[model samples]
Target: MKTLTLDLSGIYTAVTPQSIQAWEEKSNQYQQQLHAGTGLGNDFLGWINLPCEISEEQLSSIEEAARGLQERCDYVVSIGIGGSYLGARAVIEALTPSFEAYQTKHTAPQVIFAGHNIGEDYLSELVAFLRDKRFGLINISKSGTTTEPAIAFRILKALLEEQVGREEARERIIAVTDKARGALRTLADKEGYKTFIIPDDIGGRFSVLTPVGLLPIAVAGFDIRELVRGAREMKALVDESVPFAENPSALYAAARNSLYQAGKKIEILGNFHPRLHYIGEWWKQLYGESEGKDHKGIFNASVDFSADLHSMGQWIQEGERSIFETIVSIAEPNTTLRIESDEANLDGLNYLAGKRVDEVNKMAELGVRVAHIDGGVPNIRIVLPKLDAYYIGQLFYFFEKAVGISGYMLEVNPFNQPGVEAYKKNMFALLEKPGFEAETEAIKARLK
Candidate 1:
C-alpha cells in the first residue's frame, strides 16, 4: 500500500527547507490551474484526469488487441518517437528479464521499438533481423506524417505485407493515431487495420496512459489494469485539494525549483538498479521537454549507477559544482541473490560474504549520497517500495504531475514543444520537399 515517496532531506544543505516550502502556495496555485483548465497549455490537459477517465471498456479493448498480437507475432515492433514509445518501452524494459534475448522461451511476443531515429544502418539491420521472424507493427503517430515514424512505417508495412500477404498483414498492424484525421488514420481506415485513438487534448509525451502506451504495454504481457490503478492512486494523492506538506508531486516540484534558483542548473537522475534505465530516459524527456524553455529550466540528465559509478562517478564527485542528483532508490528487488563464502576469496569480496547483493548496493548508494553532499552537490531521493507495474505507473504519474507544477513555477508552457520544429523545416528544405522550394533555394545559396 505504500506508494512512491520523495525525500528532500538530501537537498537541505544546498537550499533551506523554508525556501523549498515557499513554493507550496505557488505549486498549489499551478496545480489548481491544471485542474481548472486555466494554464497556458491548458488545451492539452487531457492527461490530468486520464487515469480516472479511462473506462473498463477501453482497457478491455486494448487488452483484446494485445491478445491478438501476442497470439500472432513472435516479435512486435512499436514504432514511434519521444513520448509515443518511451513510456511503453520504459515499463516493458523494467519488468522484463535482463537477459530476455538469450532466454530460450517467451510466453508473449518480444516488443521492440523503432522510428525514434533515422539511422539507416539501424533500420537496415532491423529489416534483416525481421525478414524471417513472425513480426507485427504498432504504428503510433497523431499526424502519421512525422518524418521518422512515417518513413519507418512505410518500410515495415511493406515487409510485413510481403511476408504475410497484404490481407493478413492488415490484421497484424495496429495504428494508434488521431481519431478522425492524419495520414496514419487515413491509411488505417483504408487498409482496415485495428485502430486506437490518441486523444486530441493529450500531447505525445503524456499519451502513455492512452492507447498510445497501453496497447503496446498490454501486448508485452504486463498488467495494464494494475498500472492504471497505480496512476489513479497517485492522481488522487497529488490533487490540488491535498495539503502541500503531504503531496509528493508538490514537494518534488518545489525542491527542484528551489535548487534551480540556488544555482544548481543540472539535475542528474541516478539509479542503482539497471532495469530502470529507460525510466531515466523517459523522465528526461518528460522534464526536459516540459520545462526546458524560456531559457530558464534545469538541464535534465541521467546515469546508470554501479556501472556509471566507474565512468561518470569521478566527474560527479569532483566536476563542476552546478549539478545535483536525484536518485531513484528501489527498496526491494524482484529477485534475491546473496553473496556466498568463497574458499579462495581471490577477489577480496569475502568481507561481503552472507550479505544480500541489495545490501551492498544500498550501502554504496548511501556512501555516494554522503560523498556527493560533502562534495557540495545536493541530492533528492525518490523511494519506490518495489519495481512492479503498479510502482512504475505511480512513478510515471508522479513525475508528470510534478513537471507540470515545475514548468508553471518556471513560467513556461509545460505542454507545448514549439522549438522542436526548427530542425524539421531545415531538413525538409535540404531534401527539396516540394513545399519547401523557397527554403531549399535559400539554403542552397547559403551553402555556396
Candidate 2:
C-alpha cells in the first residue's frame, strides 16, 4: 500500500539545508523526549504510541458500537468542539460524497455535527430538522460542562426523549468521555448510554485514532481497521529508530521550524481537493493549538485552491514574506472525468478537450506553486497517493507526530492549552455562573 509522503524541496530556497539539519537534531531530541516521557507535556505522551498501541479488541468494540448506531439511525449527530468533532468530520467529509446528504441512497448513516458552536439559528434548524428524522447522538467531551456542547446536548436530549421516549433515547445516545469521572461519564453510567473512554493522557486534538474519531468514521461506513492499520504503519515508519532524513514526519517538523526561524510566521495549508477542506480545519486546530503558545509559533491557516485562488490568491502571492504554504497534493483522483470536445468551441476550452479534469487541476496546482514561489512564498508539498481511509489515516498521524516535534522545537508545552480557558472564564463570569461571583462583579464594574 502506498503511503503519504512529504516533500520539502520547494522550501529549500527559503530554508537552507544547513538550517534543516540543525532543526532535525533538535527534532530528534524532542522525539527522544516524547518517547522517554521527559518532555514538558510528558503526561500527555500517551498519543505518542497510540496508533500502535490500540488493540484488536478495542477496535472491535468500537465497530460494534458504531454498528448499533448505524442499525438504528438515519442520521448521527457527532457533538463536540475542536478536536472532538474536527477529526471525525474531517475523515467523514473526505470519504463521503460531497452531495451524500442530498442523495437518495447511502449505505451508512449521514453524519452531521453540532455542539461545536453556539449559533442560535444553527441549533434551532438542527433541532427542527431532526424532528422527523431518526438520529443518534454521539456526545463527546471530557467534562459534560463545555458550554456549547452542553447546551446542545441538553436541548437535543429533551427533544429526543420527547420524540422517542426516555428509554429508547438513552439507548440511542453514546457518550465518549473520561472513564472514571466527568459529568458525562456519570450520566452515561446512570442512564445506561453506550460509552467509550477518551484516554486520560491523550488531549482532544490528538485523539483521532482513539474512539473519539474512529467510532464516527465507522458509523459513517468507512473502514476503521484500515485506518488504524495505516496509522500504525506510519507509526513504524516515523519511529525514533528511523533516521531524520528518511522520516517524513521528522523532515516536515524540521522544514517547518526552519522556515519559522527564517521569519516565515504563517503556514497556509492549501489543498486543491474540496473534500480536504475539513482536513485543513483539523490540521489548523492540531498545529495551532499545539504550537501556538507563549507568544510564539506559526500562524496556521488554510485555503482550498482554484476556489480560494480567486479569493485569497493575491494576498498569498504578494502578501508579506512572512507567509509560507504547505500544499496537500492528491496524486490520483478517485473518479475519471474527461473534458469532452465541443463542436461550436464558443467558450474556447477546446484546447484541453481530451484531458482529464484532474490533469487540469494538477497544472493549476503546479502553476500556483511556481507563481507563489516567485512572489516570495515558500512552499511545502505533502503528496498522498490517493484519498482513501488508509492514506487519510496516514496523513492524520503524520501531522500529529510533526506537530509534537514542531511544538517542542518552539519551546512550548503543546499538550496543555492554558490559553483556551481565558475566554471561558470571562464568559462564565459575565453569565454569573455559580462560583464566579467575584469575577462577575469585577467584570460588571469593568463593563460599567
Candidate 3:
C-alpha cells in the first residue's frame, strides 16, 4: 500500500492512469512468461523469489544454517561466479559496508569470497590468510564441473581439512548445488557435508533472494525477513498499475528501453550516495551479462557522482555523444541527517548552513540536468524516496524483469551466457590442459 502511493515521475507532472494500466497489462503477461523467461522457473528472472514457493520453515532453516556456519567456522568462502556471486555481493555491499565484513566488536562471523576466480596468487593469499582459521566453504555451481569455483573449492577444502580435520571439515562445509547431482553435490554427499538447495526454479544470478542470498545475509546477521518482505512487496506492486507515479519500477524499465532505442549506447548509473554504488554494479552485471551480446544494447557502467566527478566527470560533460545515464537519485532519507548550523562561519560558507541534504541534492540534480540537456545527453533519473530493505527489493526485481523483456525484444536469450563461455573455454584450455596450442601457434606465426 505504501509502495502504491509513492510519487516518482521526475520532470513530468504526474503519472497517468493509462500508463499504469499499460504497465499492469505488461506485468500480467510477464507473470506467464516469468518461468518461461529462463530455463529455470518464472521468478528465476535473477534467481530471486519463488512466488510463495519457499516456506517460512525453510527460511528459518536457512537462518539456522547461517548460525551453524557461524558456530563451526570462523569464516565462509562462497564459491560462485557471475550472478551466483554478484547478487549476494550486491546485498552484502548495499546493507553492510565492505569494512564491516571482517571487523567490528559484534561480528556475525567472517566471510571471505573465493573461487570466483582461479588466479594462483589470489587463491594462495586467501589460503594463506585463512590457514589456521576455522572456515567452511559454501561452494555454488549447477554442474559442479565449472573450472573456477571447482578449482578454488578443491584447494580450500584441502586447507579446511588440515585445519578442522577432514571429518570436522565436512561438517563445517555446505553445498548449495544441484539437487539431483553435480561434481560438487556428489563430493558433498560423500563427505557427509551439510546441504542447501540452489533451487530447481532459480538460476545462480537470480538466486540471491532465495537460499543463495538468505544464507549469506542470515550468516551476516542482517534482517533477512525484511529483505524478502521487501521483494514480496515489489512483486505485488508490479501487478498493480493504479497511480502512475507509484509504479516506479515499471516506468523506469519502459523509459530506459525507450532511450536505448533512440541511439543511446551507454548508461551511467550515478548515485550521490556512495552506499548505493553496488546497486549500480548489480545493474551493470544485470544489463551487461544479460543484453551485452551481439552488440545490441547500451553498455552499463556505474559511478558515484561526488567521487567520480573528480575523475570521469569531464568526458561525460564534453565527450562524444554516446550515453544515456540512469541516475538512481533518492529523494527522501531513511533517517534525518541534521543540517547543523555553522557556529564559527569559517569562509563565506554560512549560506550553506542549516540546509537539508535533500535541499543540497536538489540543486545538484538541477545542475546535472542543465549540463546534460545542453550537451545533448538524455538522462532517465530513478528517484527513490528512501533506501530500505523493501524499496531496494522492488528496485532489483524491477530491473531484472526489465532486462528479460528487453532481451526478448532484442531477439536474444537474456538468461544464457553463450558469449561468456568463450572466456571459460580459453581458461580451461590454458589452466587444466597445457594451453591453446593452435591459438598459440597462430600467435607465433603472426610474430614471425
Stretches > 4 Å off in candidate 3 = 4-32, 35-51, 97-104, 240-248, 334-344, 356-362, 432-448
Q: Which 10 successive residues of model 2 have the least lDDT summed?
A: 19-28
Per-residue lDDT of candidate 3, residues 82-190 (tens digit):
7667777677767665457446454666666777777899998998999887778888787787878888988888898888788788777888888878887888788
lDDT tens readout by residue for model 2, 266-286? 999999999999999999999
Task: Indicate which candidate wins on lDDT.
Answer: 1
TM-score of each: 0.99, 0.99, 0.85
Off by over 4 Å in 1: none
Task: Single out the weakest 10-residue window by summed lDDT for candidate 1.
Answer: 20-29
Q: Which sections of candidate 2 miss by over 4 Å?
A: none
Each candidate: what lDDT?
0.94, 0.92, 0.69
lDDT ranking from best to worst?
Answer: 1, 2, 3
The alpha-carbon RMSD values of the candidates against the true structure, listed in the order shown, are: 0.8, 0.9, 4.1
Query: Over the stretch 177-228, how does candidate 1's per-residue lDDT look in tens digits?
Result: 9999989999999999999999999988898899999999999899999999
What local lDDT score does residue 265 receive in model 2, on the 0 to 100 scale? 95
Order of the predicted models by TM-score, top scorer first: 1, 2, 3
